[model samples]
Target: MTPYQRWTLRTDATSYTVRLSADGPWAELDAWGPHGVETGPSALDWSHRTHFFTPADAAPAEYLPYGLRPFTGADLVASRPGEERGVWWEFAGAEEDEGALRLAFTDEVLGLRTVLCYRTVPGTDVILRWTEFTSSRELRLERLDSAAVTVPVTGPARLTYLTGQWSQEFQHTRLDLSRGTFSMGSTQGAPGHAYAPWLAVQDGENGPAYGVALEWPGNWHLTAQAEPGGFVRVRAGRVPHEGAVYLTPGETLTTPRLACAFSAEGLDGLSRVWHRYERHLSGERLRRPRKVLYNSWEATAFDVDAAGQLELAKTAADIGAELFVVDDGWFTGRADDTGGLGDWYPDPAAFPDGFGRFVDDVRALGLDFGLWIEPEAVSPGSELYAEHPDWVYRIEDRPARLVRNQLLLDLGRTDVQDFVIGTLDRLLTEYDISYLKWDMNRPPTERSRPGAGPADRLDLDAQHVAGYLHVLDHLRSAHPHVTVEGCAGGGARVDHATLARTDVLWPSDNTAPLDRLAIQYGFLHAHAPHVMSSWVTDAPGVFDPRSRSLAFRFVNAMCGVLGIGADLRHWDADQRAEAARWIARYKDVRDVVHLGEARLLGSPRDVTCGVQYDGADGRTVVAALSTGPLDGAPLVPGRPARLRLRGLDAAATYRDADSGAAYSGAHLLHYGLPFAWSAAHDAELVVLTRE
Candidate 1:
């Protein structure tokens, strides 16, 4: 009798156990949840067998290839030119070191070695999982997923994911899964606004939540299937180019890390697990306080001039902006989106006094200078494109498709990567630029490399991702002083890989107060607030037309890294004064807001919704908002809307910073902090300090 082998990986608050069945070579999930789950009966016990299905197919597999998981979805699908499209592998060995573990399997006939790797993030309940494949023979990998997670669910699986379009990005969507499969992915070169590379699952409405997030920045997919044997499995990884990727002999292909998290406290608690892991990814960089920025896009647009920008810089400085960013139109030939994209040089006409002089002048106003650039795109009429027409993605005979009035450069090529690095290095070296807002306005429409071989074409996506990361890595190492803000139209390129490289992320282009509130509500669920770069703009409400005051806008943006895109030059004296006050207030509580334990109080759907941050010093800051009108009626007559705060010390007494009012923590937790809603005041910033 072959004894079943078991291994358990433990994090700060969670545990994941994997077992190799005596009946087969495959690994099955024994338990995944709170720390003590492994001590209980196995979640994947053999009792729940399915008819007409192989034991390997019905079992909660940790990771399996096509031959083993024949009936179910496979994590890896590979084949040689004339060989069978399945793997019949046997367990080679397993290695454990510190908090990392690796299980190896090999197919002797194919000379392929597959390693499943797992590493527990220190100080976080997150287990990072990925697979590495090395083969002696060349093969085509149709599907290579990073990790497949088998979540134990008692009832129907409830799924929650993020999905939206350009300006409407980060909308939280939910679905229940009793059976069948649900899939979401991005074929675009980026992690598209259509769907984020993240998913959260639960057993039922009240069960513990499990989450999986892929770290890939390029095209990726996440699929969840509720099997007939009463179990849910999720597979996530980078989406291969076209439908397959080529693996050369002796070359190893490592999939992106998939972060798997569990929280017995629910989805909101699961969010904190993600947040802590992100902060861990930030390392020492998280200590640097994100600046309050002022962008001149809405004010100047393409009509940029030195004097006008200098004037705006002075106003921005007066309003307490630490950074002044010249967004778009600062570069040569960039009068509109149609041209000047590939031209990285500053426009001589717009900056008649010289670009360096303009940057110096902005710095003279006591504000750090920042510039926006889309390095991966090109305009047909631009000099760079004309000089090297073969640089963009296109087949030899097919016409290059245009998106956002521009073409995407084939970043997979080394020459293109060098150009991007050189262009950015020149800009940062020449000027005293402290920030770079890296924007990708469009996805690759015709993603193909001319004259490339079939194998090369299949490797395009992976190479492009590597090249993109290379440029970002160069910026980090070559110029560490510069703060990189990641943007893709609006949150299109957001993922752990991008977030690990960038200092901040622009959530959306739509800054309309109510619309932004909903976006932030969803954004905070999967991402930490410290990385969310939200802006306050004067744009009219697109999703919700109900007008909100400037205070509301400031409070909404203050939920993350606050930036002002509204034209300060057009503001009246009172508005400027109010803006200055809000800016000052944000600065006072910024540390707590950025580093504190964040909790979503009431949801955006509620009449009174807010974000609460509890600081280490026992100071709590709440950005409360009134989502709907209070003119007609109230839910309960003679009662104001209240937000019951969480994570409060029940016996502590707290005092408001501004109102000078005091209340008990027990009272606030049970009855909540009350809000008197009115048309004039639809939002309020409450700062409470424990006494």
Candidate 2:
């Protein structure tokens, strides 16, 4: 391991070495596959090799620059009191933990102490990076960035990121990395749907691909700048939206964790590495087999009541739904999005006998019960809001701005935090609720507290997230049996911080099968499939007008945690029977589909796109969808060709679950399976078991 240098970090497949330069300190990356970390003598030292004409100590114009240097392109940016020039950090030394490396630096002039942290796990190729800042005297920092790493670029390079808006999340976009700064972030109080806090740069058409993802749930920023040399400096951290954090003497501020992953095998390889790291943290694939759930949101939005929910539960149970969730309109005065947010109590008129009988009825139908709750928001007309006027986020003199006719509950306050936890605790304790759909319908607005200015409100943003997580942690600890699904009006609050506490995530409010192909595709690139909860909702979709067959919808939703949000009562006998069969098939192969390695077969934007799931055992499942004209016309000239399966045992004999035809895995992989579906938006699911 390169003799275990004091200022070096190594993952299973990569090595990052740092050194003190005349201008500051910089890091160079070398990555290899499973063979091991590459620490050969030929490794280039970019710090002092003089990539530019300027001397390293003479105000670095090239070479590699860091927070410790006098450079404009610094990875870390900060300002302290009484500093005429920009603050420069000096390397003090380094320290090593069990699986982490820490490099310490200090700016004596500003009485600021900085430490950069890098960590790695055994099976992952990701290097986790973050920065810690401490001050001896009180100071205000304009900006504090997490650790930054310089990646070598060769030939042409491209930067790929995900972007979307409400109802349309996780749309992957790629742009070539240019000379200037390329950046994307969330200025909204929370991580907005416009962009996910992640970025990737692929250097050369065939060289290694490196990526970084911020683990913060609040507003975050990431920037990539191409330097004079063939290197790109990337930095990411929490965004200082209000500017200037007033740091107390003994109070230390740590930036959000920024994780970097490297793969010599390109974007797919890097994506898989990230997937493994996420799975390692979430236990996503190893957790109890995900249930076939039915959420009654699209079915009965604001009309949730006892008799209707009971009928829906019966229909859902008949179709093999293991969990029945009643979404929205369950609480007092909650007829729509405008009212009854903070009041967690059941509506006396809607549920005349309370939720006890409904819960029992659902449980009797052989399905687990779940309730949807939005703990972080309150309507202005809610009784809770009327009672606790100071609980919501509000400016001192300005009137509160309401989104969806609801104001954000200030979890930053201890009392507000207690109320949220207490209400959830009471629900779990009273009812037989196995799942809780924790939701945040709107982003925070008018976030300033009564006495705190805008700068101080920045602290509220961070604290609210912490408080949100604190409540989740307490819930998980107390109700160990209940599983939580995190939602922000569907997918806005998806990040490491939220994923760590929740069991599943709603990728988007838009569940149209055709659109979901692209949405789920982008989502699975970072998050594991098991943690993604996709539903087959009623269409004529809310977002798109493309009418898809139920079979196509089933396969799309089955790719993740299979769910149904369609109104079962409106379905005909044949449709219900077909749904029952599909649900049965999903349950039969869910082990492979939920816990196995996922492989995307084709681009979602193309005429044909599909996914392959390979289990540790000898089972494999392939779900393919045709987006082009399939009925009478061919997308191409002739009929579609066969689809070759992936990650199968080539020598083993396999049997098709439907046809019961036996074939060699080698033949299946070589000759490929026949593509039967020809109708537009038609999907096919094939399950193969080794014999």
Q: Please give the TM-score that candidate 1 achieves against the real structure.
A: 0.98
> Candidate 2 at residue 546, lDDT?
68
Off by over 4 Å in 2: 1-8, 22-37, 41-44, 47-72, 82-85, 452-458, 541-544, 632-638, 649-653, 661-671
Clashing pairs in 2: 630-678
lDDT of 1 by residue, 430-458 (tens): 99999999999988877778677764445
TM-score (all chains, Cα) for each model: 0.98, 0.93
Per-residue alpha-carbon lDDT of model 2 for 1-691, expressed as tens digits?
2322334566777765555443334333433233334456423244444543433322212122233354436554455555553555556777887678776767787787878777886778777888888888777666677756566666445888889998889988888775768888886767778899888787755567778889888878888777666667677878754655667787798878888888777777777777778778776325777899999988999899999999999999988899999999998898888899988988878888877987998899999999999999899998998999899887778888888888998887889989998999999999999899998888777767775544543577677778888998898789978889999987898888888788889989888877787888888877788789999877666555667799999999998899999989999999999999999999988888866778787676666677888888877888888776666344345555566766577889988888998878888788777665565447889887888
Q: How displaced is residue 221 in candidate 1, in Å?
A: 0.8
Q: In model 2, state the lDDT of residue 192.
A: 79
Error of 2 at 227 (Å): 1.6
| Highest-TM-score candidate | 1
- Distance from true location, Cα of 568 in model 2, Å: 0.6
